[model samples]
Target: MTDVEALRQQVAGLMPKVRQDLERLVRIPSISAAGYDAEPVRTSAEATAEILNDAGLAARVIDGEGGHPAVIGSISAPDGAPMVLLYAHHDVQPTGPEELWSTPPFEPTERDGRLFARGAADDKAGVMVHAAAIRAWDGRPPVGVSVFIEGEEEAGSEHLPDLLARYADHLRADAVILADSTNWRVGQPALTTSLRGLVGCTIEVRTLDHAVHSGMYGGPIPDALTALCRTLAALHDERGTVAVPGLKSEPSDPLDLQEDEFRAWAGVRPGVEMIGEGGLTERLWTKPAAYVLAIDAPRTKEAPGQLVPSVRATVGLRVAPGDSAADAVGALVDHLKASVPWGAELTVLDSFSGEPYRV
Candidate 1:
């Protein structure tokens, strides 16, 4: 029988080293967002390879075709044991406006018994967890362990299929455990059972041939910004439930989650009623949601008193499970086209989609 107490103590003893290794990874600024430097991502991949190797896995850094570097590491299991694939991504989302951060985005800081930094938990933490498990076993885990640390998950895992195809043999396993996700709350463990697929596109709304003085065109003629805003507003109904037709929603299993507890946990402000027409868990897990992720227009301070000729927005939609990415994206595009006001010109570009998955 496994000695649970001994294992717990052994893990507790090595936490400092784990923290140090995680801090090293967090300092690398491996932002995989487009237009950022690529070198840091490669550096981060190499660092991940080193961490796995030091933990007794035979690891190396490899690049995906036309994509960023990824780290693959593995240790063989004892005879008759099963192979397990462990997954985590080293690449992090671009840190928008570092000025908003409490400390340097790459500098690991500890306060109130928590560490702060970009990628601190969003997966450098997961990577370290896997490493810690290996070390706790004294580098010989009971099952075969294969580690896959992709470098561009934040940038949308564009080449994951290629990588998987290339390394099919190395990654074969009886089970796969993704070292990622959020806990229910502090001291409460929760396994994430599903993730809604992602779909989105950049939409441009053009109202006029060229920019004109807003004072002259204000009442008589419409501006692209107003048209864009109106179109986006059409995405939801009176109850704030998604207004788009053809998008899917399914009833989720009930849980003991009350509105007050949800508000307290989610930081819902006073009098700000939550949107969506369903149980909170269903709305979050099974129903589709729409969001305006970003917009292209003049900055507020730099705005001129002119009727903008064109405006663009990135509309993102969470696709519910059992729905195809193709169908979800097609539905979104069709709705956006049908919803545009006053016959303003519309064009969609940079469409992207990821299929919803369950295991």
Candidate 2:
């Protein structure tokens, strides 16, 4: 039989064991986000290392600066062959509420030819795909294989750079396959060519030293909350397109999503017009803009019928591909400071920024 056919047979034979392995992994609640216990993350990393070792690779668990563990494994290739890196994460996102799940989040259950579990579809499945592929070749594929299963991806990948730098020599490869992203749809494959970067900051507006009765100072003096809202409104024009200056936007790829499909997917109510001034793909994928993430203001129940003295809001900006996140953040800060209404005092505090990737 040809190499391809031989590998296919081997994979078919390993399906049962693969399912068992995946179920074992899905049982671990390896949530690496804030407020979750860290022990399961380490346990998941150890389990991943063991799986890699079973596939004949020399596997080890390494901890990055964030103290989250990562599993690394490798197998040598035949002479004159290329080296390939397979990347996935071992940690899973938090199960929002147990009551929402029909079955326990950690218990792997199968229904309608699908496995149900917190990490079954996300990343633990990805880990099994790699393991099964390696096992098909008996851990001796034609091309070199390097496996990197990270633990902090769901937590924003804050320490990914540090981990990469620390293991540069071992993780080096001519090509990489990131198995975290979704396929276009089931049974269809797609290659993601571009992704937008992110930058965020908190803007605090102060117009008075203390609150005053609205009846006394409402007409002449604009409240800090009002000034902040006006400043935010200026970031988007009537068309809902971002109006921030010095931000970058680029022409999008040819692929487009139909308006009806988008509406159904986004759950837009009927008769509500969509905002933005360009093709949906370009506006979403290759654009720089602002979004209000959270606002710090009193609720209606807590209102004191007084003029607000200060307001704070967290704003997030998505930097388009081919643009630098640092530059985008700088421009956004300048825009917010210059846009404050009625000479209100403004302070912009940066939270975090991530560089965009195009691959």
Candidate 3:
């Protein structure tokens, strides 16, 4: 058989074992966020390295500065072969609420052809794919290979750039396969590109020293919560497009994912239409989108019927790839400052921002 055909046959034979290994790794809840415990993250990384070693590579853990440990492994090929880099991560996002999942998020379960777990679809499957492909190559391919599986991608790869730089020589390759988070249909493959830059800010509006009865002070005094919501509401137009200046980018030609297929894949409610116009790719990849992620104002359970003293909310902006987070945030802040209703005093604080990458 031809090399490609041979590789495909080998990988086909290894699929069952690969699925088992992926399930084994996905069973562990390797959350790397600040609030979650760290041992699981470490355990997942170490276990991943062991998997790679068993596949005929020298693998071990490298301690990232503050994030979870990173996994690096290498397998040598014959001299004069090309080297490729394989990337993946071991950690996952928190399961969120238990009710949101059909099955327990940490418990790896299989229904139909797809595996269901918090990390199953994310990176655990990617890791298994890499292992299967390499093992199909039988310890060495026509090319050299190095793998870097991280433990903190979901929490932002805070320390990976440094790790990449530190191990630059080892990671140098003709191509890098980042198999952490993306897919296009089950059979069709996709190479994800152009990540939207993200910037977030919280605006706090303070009006009186303390809470007062709404019946008495509702007319003259400003309700901080109302003012905050109004300001946030103005950030988007009636069509859901961002209304802020300089935050928008040139829209690109839209991509075509079959409408019925997309709806079914996303599990959208029947008869619900998709939002925005143009190509699916253009709307998501090139345009700016603003959302109010959270409101930190007093809860109604504790909120007195009062002209509240203060209210706060968070705004998140997803800018096109070329747009800078700083500039987008500056425009957003400016718009909020100018748009505050009445003579209400406003305080805006910029929060974490990550430069959007074009992968």
- Highest-TM-score candidate: 1
lDDT of each: 0.92, 0.89, 0.83
- Candidate 3, 1-359: lDDT as tens digits: 35788777888888888888898899889998889999999999888998888787789999998779989988774688778899988898998899988999988877997778898978888888777767887767678899999889899889988998999988888878878656667877788876788888988887777888999878988887888878888887777667888776756765657778877877999977666556777777788878889888777788666777888888888888888988888888898888889867889754768777775
TM-score of 1: 0.94
Candidate with maximal lDDT: 1
What's the lDDT for candidate 2?
0.89
- Could you give me the TM-score of model 3 versus the true structure? 0.91
lDDT of 3 at 136: 85
Off by over 4 Å in 3: 76-80, 267-274
Q: Per-residue lDDT tens digits of candidate 2, residues 1-359?
A: 35778777899999999999999999999999999999999999999999889977889999987668999989876898889999999999999989999999999999978899999989998999899888988888889999999999899888888989989989999999888776654556677778899998898999999999999888998899999999899878898888878888899865646888778867999999988877878887898767999989878899998999999999999999999988988888888888998999999755678888898
Residue 72 Cα positional deviation in candidate 2, in Å, after optimal superposition: 0.8
Which residue runs of candidate 1 sit more than 4 Å off their true CA positions?
256-261, 264-266
Write candidate 1's Cα lDDT for 1-359 as tens digits.
78999999999999999999999999999998889999999999999999989998999999998899999999998999999998999999888898999898899999888899999999899999889999999899889999899999888889999999999999999998888898876667687778899999899999999999988878888899999999999999988999889998889997767889889987989999899987888998899999999999989999999999999999999998888899999999999999999999999977999888776
User: What C-alpha lDDT, on a 0 to 100 scale, does residue 19 get in candidate 2?
Assistant: 97
In model 2, state the lDDT of residue 77: 66
Whole-structure CA lDDT of model 3 = 0.83
TM-score to true structure, per model: 0.94, 0.88, 0.91
